[model samples]
Target: MQDNYQALKEAGAEVYSVSVDTHFVHKAWHDNSERISKLEYTMISDSNKELARELDILDESGKALRATFVLDPENVIQTVEINADGIGRKADVNINKIKAGKYIASHPGEACPAKWEEEGDDVLTPGLDLVGKL
Candidate 1:
Protein backbone atom coordinates (compact mmCIF):
# COMPACT_ATOMS: atom_id res chain seq x y z
CA MET A 1 0.00 0.00 0.00
CA GLN A 2 2.94 2.31 0.47
CA ASP A 3 3.45 2.36 -3.27
CA ASN A 4 -0.05 3.66 -3.89
CA TYR A 5 -0.50 5.79 -0.80
CA GLN A 6 -0.72 8.97 -2.82
CA ALA A 7 -3.49 7.56 -4.99
CA LEU A 8 -5.47 6.66 -1.90
CA LYS A 9 -5.07 10.12 -0.46
CA GLU A 10 -6.12 11.75 -3.72
CA ALA A 11 -9.29 9.71 -3.60
CA GLY A 12 -10.25 11.49 -0.38
CA ALA A 13 -9.12 8.76 1.99
CA GLU A 14 -6.58 8.52 4.75
CA VAL A 15 -4.60 5.32 5.19
CA TYR A 16 -3.79 3.84 8.59
CA SER A 17 -2.39 0.43 9.38
CA VAL A 18 -3.55 -1.07 12.68
CA SER A 19 -1.99 -4.15 14.17
CA VAL A 20 -2.10 -6.01 17.46
CA ASP A 21 1.67 -5.87 17.71
CA THR A 22 3.44 -3.45 20.01
CA HIS A 23 4.92 -0.19 18.77
CA PHE A 24 8.43 -1.49 19.21
CA VAL A 25 7.71 -4.52 17.07
CA HIS A 26 6.20 -2.35 14.38
CA LYS A 27 9.22 -0.11 14.43
CA ALA A 28 11.51 -3.10 14.28
CA TRP A 29 9.75 -4.44 11.24
CA HIS A 30 9.77 -1.08 9.60
CA ASP A 31 13.46 -0.83 10.18
CA ASN A 32 14.26 -4.35 9.08
CA SER A 33 11.83 -4.96 6.28
CA GLU A 34 12.51 -3.30 2.98
CA ARG A 35 8.84 -3.23 2.05
CA ILE A 36 7.85 -1.40 5.22
CA SER A 37 10.79 0.95 5.41
CA LYS A 38 9.38 3.63 3.15
CA LEU A 39 5.87 3.76 4.48
CA GLU A 40 4.63 7.31 5.13
CA TYR A 41 1.23 6.52 6.57
CA THR A 42 0.48 6.16 10.24
CA MET A 43 0.90 2.77 11.83
CA ILE A 44 -1.27 2.29 14.88
CA SER A 45 -0.29 -0.11 17.62
CA ASP A 46 -3.26 -1.91 19.03
CA SER A 47 -1.41 -4.12 21.47
CA ASN A 48 -4.28 -4.22 23.95
CA LYS A 49 -6.66 -5.31 21.18
CA GLU A 50 -9.04 -2.53 22.09
CA LEU A 51 -9.46 -1.55 18.44
CA ALA A 52 -9.53 -5.18 17.37
CA ARG A 53 -12.28 -6.05 19.80
CA GLU A 54 -14.28 -3.02 18.76
CA LEU A 55 -13.93 -4.02 15.13
CA ASP A 56 -14.74 -7.67 15.99
CA ILE A 57 -11.72 -8.97 14.10
CA LEU A 58 -9.90 -10.59 16.98
CA ASP A 59 -9.20 -14.30 16.68
CA GLU A 60 -9.20 -16.89 19.44
CA SER A 61 -5.41 -16.55 19.75
CA GLY A 62 -5.78 -12.90 20.78
CA LYS A 63 -4.57 -11.76 17.40
CA ALA A 64 -6.33 -9.62 14.93
CA LEU A 65 -7.59 -11.25 11.76
CA ARG A 66 -6.42 -9.95 8.40
CA ALA A 67 -8.94 -7.25 7.65
CA THR A 68 -9.35 -3.85 6.07
CA PHE A 69 -12.09 -1.37 6.75
CA VAL A 70 -12.93 1.65 4.60
CA LEU A 71 -14.76 4.26 6.63
CA ASP A 72 -16.18 7.51 5.37
CA PRO A 73 -15.64 11.00 6.78
CA GLU A 74 -18.36 10.36 9.34
CA ASN A 75 -16.55 7.23 10.58
CA VAL A 76 -19.29 5.10 9.10
CA ILE A 77 -18.02 1.82 7.81
CA GLN A 78 -18.50 1.73 4.07
CA THR A 79 -16.53 -1.37 3.14
CA VAL A 80 -15.19 -4.35 5.04
CA GLU A 81 -12.76 -6.90 3.62
CA ILE A 82 -11.63 -9.80 5.73
CA ASN A 83 -9.07 -12.14 4.24
CA ALA A 84 -7.89 -15.59 5.11
CA ASP A 85 -4.43 -16.05 6.57
CA GLY A 86 -2.94 -16.86 3.21
CA ILE A 87 -4.59 -14.00 1.39
CA GLY A 88 -3.19 -10.56 0.78
CA ARG A 89 -4.78 -7.23 0.10
CA LYS A 90 -4.38 -5.17 -3.07
CA ALA A 91 -3.80 -1.44 -2.77
CA ASP A 92 -5.41 -0.75 -6.11
CA VAL A 93 -8.58 -2.54 -5.06
CA ASN A 94 -8.88 -0.51 -1.89
CA ILE A 95 -8.29 2.67 -3.85
CA ASN A 96 -11.18 1.79 -6.12
CA LYS A 97 -13.43 1.08 -3.18
CA ILE A 98 -12.63 4.45 -1.66
CA LYS A 99 -13.49 6.22 -4.89
CA ALA A 100 -16.77 4.37 -5.16
CA GLY A 101 -17.64 5.19 -1.58
CA LYS A 102 -16.92 8.88 -2.02
CA TYR A 103 -19.10 9.01 -5.11
CA ILE A 104 -21.96 7.32 -3.33
CA ALA A 105 -21.69 9.59 -0.32
CA SER A 106 -21.92 12.70 -2.44
CA HIS A 107 -24.79 11.44 -4.56
CA PRO A 108 -27.60 10.48 -2.27
CA GLY A 109 -30.05 7.80 -3.40
CA GLU A 110 -27.45 6.31 -5.70
CA ALA A 111 -25.56 3.06 -5.35
CA CYS A 112 -22.34 1.78 -6.82
CA PRO A 113 -22.47 -1.43 -8.78
CA ALA A 114 -20.34 -4.45 -7.94
CA LYS A 115 -17.66 -3.47 -10.48
CA TRP A 116 -17.69 0.27 -10.07
CA GLU A 117 -14.10 1.53 -10.05
CA GLU A 118 -13.88 5.27 -10.63
CA GLU A 119 -15.70 8.57 -10.94
CA GLY A 120 -16.99 8.05 -14.47
CA ASP A 121 -18.26 4.54 -13.89
CA ASP A 122 -21.99 3.88 -13.86
CA VAL A 123 -24.08 3.98 -10.68
CA LEU A 124 -27.51 2.66 -9.82
CA THR A 125 -30.56 4.58 -8.74
CA PRO A 126 -33.10 2.09 -7.45
CA GLY A 127 -36.42 2.61 -9.17
CA LEU A 128 -39.24 0.73 -10.85
CA ASP A 129 -37.37 0.38 -14.15
CA LEU A 130 -34.47 -1.39 -12.47
CA VAL A 131 -36.46 -3.62 -10.16
CA GLY A 132 -35.29 -7.06 -11.24
CA LYS A 133 -33.23 -6.30 -14.34
CA LEU A 134 -29.90 -6.43 -12.58
Candidate 2:
Protein backbone atom coordinates (compact mmCIF):
# COMPACT_ATOMS: atom_id res chain seq x y z
CA MET A 1 0.00 0.00 0.00
CA GLN A 2 2.87 2.34 0.65
CA ASP A 3 3.85 1.94 -2.99
CA ASN A 4 0.44 3.27 -4.06
CA TYR A 5 0.38 6.17 -1.64
CA GLN A 6 0.60 8.74 -4.42
CA ALA A 7 -2.38 7.25 -6.21
CA LEU A 8 -4.44 7.19 -3.05
CA LYS A 9 -3.51 10.79 -2.31
CA GLU A 10 -4.41 11.79 -5.85
CA ALA A 11 -7.80 10.18 -5.27
CA GLY A 12 -8.29 12.60 -2.36
CA ALA A 13 -7.81 10.22 0.52
CA GLU A 14 -5.11 10.50 3.14
CA VAL A 15 -3.37 7.33 4.21
CA TYR A 16 -2.35 6.52 7.77
CA SER A 17 -0.98 3.36 9.32
CA VAL A 18 -1.83 2.50 12.92
CA SER A 19 0.20 -0.09 14.78
CA VAL A 20 0.34 -1.40 18.33
CA ASP A 21 4.07 -0.75 18.48
CA THR A 22 5.61 2.05 20.43
CA HIS A 23 6.95 5.17 18.71
CA PHE A 24 10.54 4.07 19.28
CA VAL A 25 9.91 0.62 17.94
CA HIS A 26 7.97 1.96 14.99
CA LYS A 27 10.79 4.35 14.19
CA ALA A 28 13.35 1.61 14.43
CA TRP A 29 11.38 -0.69 12.19
CA HIS A 30 10.66 2.08 9.74
CA ASP A 31 14.32 2.88 9.58
CA ASN A 32 15.32 -0.74 9.13
CA SER A 33 12.65 -2.18 6.87
CA GLU A 34 13.81 -1.80 3.29
CA ARG A 35 10.32 -2.17 1.86
CA ILE A 36 8.85 0.54 4.10
CA SER A 37 11.87 2.77 4.62
CA LYS A 38 10.44 5.35 2.25
CA LEU A 39 6.90 5.39 3.55
CA GLU A 40 5.53 8.91 3.29
CA TYR A 41 2.27 8.60 5.14
CA THR A 42 1.80 9.18 8.83
CA MET A 43 2.36 6.25 11.16
CA ILE A 44 0.27 6.24 14.30
CA SER A 45 1.42 4.50 17.44
CA ASP A 46 -1.24 2.65 19.43
CA SER A 47 0.99 0.91 21.95
CA ASN A 48 -1.67 1.30 24.60
CA LYS A 49 -4.23 -0.40 22.34
CA GLU A 50 -6.55 2.58 22.68
CA LEU A 51 -7.40 2.72 19.01
CA ALA A 52 -7.56 -1.05 18.69
CA ARG A 53 -9.99 -1.33 21.59
CA GLU A 54 -12.08 1.55 20.29
CA LEU A 55 -12.31 -0.09 16.90
CA ASP A 56 -13.10 -3.44 18.53
CA ILE A 57 -10.30 -5.10 16.63
CA LEU A 58 -8.12 -6.07 19.54
CA ASP A 59 -7.61 -9.79 19.93
CA GLU A 60 -7.10 -11.92 23.04
CA SER A 61 -3.35 -11.78 22.45
CA GLY A 62 -3.46 -7.98 22.87
CA LYS A 63 -2.67 -7.48 19.20
CA ALA A 64 -4.73 -5.55 16.73
CA LEU A 65 -6.36 -7.37 13.87
CA ARG A 66 -5.36 -6.32 10.41
CA ALA A 67 -7.94 -3.76 9.39
CA THR A 68 -8.50 -0.91 7.00
CA PHE A 69 -10.88 1.98 7.37
CA VAL A 70 -11.85 4.56 4.78
CA LEU A 71 -13.18 7.78 6.23
CA ASP A 72 -14.81 10.64 4.44
CA PRO A 73 -13.94 14.32 4.74
CA GLU A 74 -16.31 14.58 7.66
CA ASN A 75 -14.34 11.87 9.46
CA VAL A 76 -17.24 9.40 9.20
CA ILE A 77 -16.24 5.88 8.35
CA GLN A 78 -17.39 5.02 4.82
CA THR A 79 -15.95 1.53 4.47
CA VAL A 80 -14.18 -0.97 6.70
CA GLU A 81 -12.40 -4.28 6.12
CA ILE A 82 -10.88 -6.55 8.71
CA ASN A 83 -8.69 -9.55 8.14
CA ALA A 84 -7.20 -12.23 10.31
CA ASP A 85 -3.50 -12.76 10.85
CA GLY A 86 -1.50 -14.04 7.87
CA ILE A 87 -3.96 -12.37 5.50
CA GLY A 88 -3.13 -9.47 3.25
CA ARG A 89 -4.98 -6.56 1.71
CA LYS A 90 -4.90 -5.32 -1.85
CA ALA A 91 -4.29 -1.66 -2.48
CA ASP A 92 -6.26 -1.61 -5.73
CA VAL A 93 -9.42 -2.87 -4.00
CA ASN A 94 -9.24 -0.21 -1.30
CA ILE A 95 -8.46 2.49 -3.84
CA ASN A 96 -11.46 1.54 -5.92
CA LYS A 97 -13.67 1.53 -2.85
CA ILE A 98 -12.39 4.98 -1.94
CA LYS A 99 -13.23 6.22 -5.40
CA ALA A 100 -16.72 4.76 -5.17
CA GLY A 101 -17.24 6.27 -1.75
CA LYS A 102 -16.15 9.70 -2.97
CA TYR A 103 -18.40 9.40 -5.99
CA ILE A 104 -21.37 8.48 -3.85
CA ALA A 105 -20.64 11.29 -1.44
CA SER A 106 -20.54 13.82 -4.28
CA HIS A 107 -23.52 12.33 -6.07
CA PRO A 108 -25.94 11.40 -3.33
CA GLY A 109 -28.55 8.71 -3.95
CA GLU A 110 -26.36 6.92 -6.44
CA ALA A 111 -24.86 3.52 -5.71
CA CYS A 112 -21.81 1.76 -7.05
CA PRO A 113 -22.20 -1.93 -7.50
CA ALA A 114 -19.77 -4.79 -6.84
CA LYS A 115 -16.28 -4.48 -8.31
CA TRP A 116 -17.07 -0.93 -9.31
CA GLU A 117 -14.17 0.70 -11.09
CA GLU A 118 -14.01 4.45 -11.50
CA GLU A 119 -13.22 4.20 -15.21
CA GLY A 120 -15.36 1.21 -15.93
CA ASP A 121 -19.03 2.35 -16.08
CA ASP A 122 -21.31 0.95 -13.39
CA VAL A 123 -23.48 3.22 -11.28
CA LEU A 124 -27.02 2.88 -10.05
CA THR A 125 -29.60 5.48 -9.16
CA PRO A 126 -32.49 3.70 -7.49
CA GLY A 127 -36.13 4.54 -8.06
CA LEU A 128 -39.44 2.75 -7.80
CA ASP A 129 -39.38 2.09 -11.54
CA LEU A 130 -36.08 0.26 -11.17
CA VAL A 131 -37.29 -2.02 -8.40
CA GLY A 132 -36.68 -5.74 -9.01
CA LYS A 133 -35.00 -4.86 -12.33
CA LEU A 134 -31.50 -5.64 -11.20
Off by over 4 Å in 1: none
Pick the TM-score winner. 1
The estimated TM-scores of all candidates read: 0.92, 0.91
Question: In candidate 1, where is summed lDDT lowest over 10 consecutive residues?
Answer: 83-92
Clashes of 1: 0
**lDDT of candidates 1 onward, in order:** 0.89, 0.88
lDDT of 2 by residue, 1-112 (tens): 8878998988888899999999998889888998768889999999999999999999999999999999989899888999999998887677888889888887889989
- Tens digits of per-residue lDDT, candidate 1, 1-134, equal 88889998888888899999999999999999998889999999999999999999998988799999999898999889998788998878988898888887789999899898877888899889998899
Give the CA lDDT, 0 to 100, for residue 84 in model 2: 99
Q: Candidate 1: TM-score?
A: 0.92
Identify the candidate with maximal lDDT: 1
